[model samples]
Target: MKKLLLATLLLLGIVTTASAQLPKVMLKSIDGKSVSTDTLSNNGKPFIIDFFATWCKPCNRELTAISEVYEEWQEETGVKVIAVSIDQAQNINKVKPLVDNHGWQYEVLLDPNSDFKRALGIQTIPYVIVCDGNGKIVSKHNGYTEGAEEELIEEVRKLVNK
Candidate 1:
């Protein structure tokens, strides 16, 4: 029990510190435009930055699950979800089609070289970072499972209320 509490605190500290500053890295748009990831702000609205790839089944599942309730989530907390594709350069071409075909409504950005991933120390897809309105990371989790997005929603609620 103590170990679990300690780990939770450690995770909270990680997010609190890391969310203060957005990383300066360029991400590609579907129109072949280079966008600085740091400029991807929510204008004082908390948001979730999800690192995913075109081929990751779990990542797709998580995003799909969140998408189902995203409208309500946004209405309640004023939060947005930013989809960051860490697909390699070779597979980068698939991102736009996948997002469009799936009808995902979030801001989709491409990280062909995974520079943002490396800078954020994200070693895996389906990684989630919840950031506050000021761009301070409040919570983070790796991987996804059923009911996981519920915990994420709670995190956003906490920060939005703060």
Candidate 2:
């Protein structure tokens, strides 16, 4: 228990202090297109990177909430969402079906080996990373709560207002 608490604190500290460029890692889109993490952008507009898995309920709820308002958000702010699924390699086949069932329109990326997640020091599912127009990570949230998506859009709104 002590070790777990210590690790949690350490990860929290890392998350708070994280403000770096996205690492270069090649991942496959849900439709099998190759994409590089370093190139994720929204034409100089802010974007969000949400890490999740098929088995995480909180992740699903958070994403579903975002999906509901994604169109409006895009029209208002030009903010794009990149949903990264950290399901294991064997479970890769589950991602597309789950995404389709939820009707999530966000760009879905497959991180079968968690290379992208580990590169960002993420230790939990439902992790969210908000990036500025320049592709620099500006904000990160580690868990989901009701209405948290509102807070996320607020963050992007700030960048747009700048």
lDDT of each: 0.87, 0.95
Q: Number of clashing residue pairs in every model?
A: 2, 0
Residue 12, model 1: Cα distance from true site in angstroms: 10
lDDT, candidate 2, equals 0.95
Q: Which candidate is the best by TM-score?
A: 2
RMSD of each: 3.5, 5.0
Candidate 2 — worst ten consecutive residues by lDDT sum? 11-20
Summarize candidate 1's per-residue lDDT along 72-104 as a digit string, tens digits: 998999889999999998998899898988888
Badly placed stretches (over 4 Å) of model 2 are 1-19
lDDT of 2 at 30: 95
How well does candidate 2 match the true structure, expressed as C-alpha RMSD?
Answer: 5.0
Predicted candidate 2 versus true structure: per-residue lDDT over 33-144, tens digit per residue: 9999999999999999999999999999999999999999999999999999999999999999999999999999999999999998899989999999999888899999
In order of appearance, the predictions have TM-scores of 0.87, 0.89
Question: Could you tell me which 10 consecutive residues in candidate 1 have the lowest summed lDDT?
Answer: 13-22
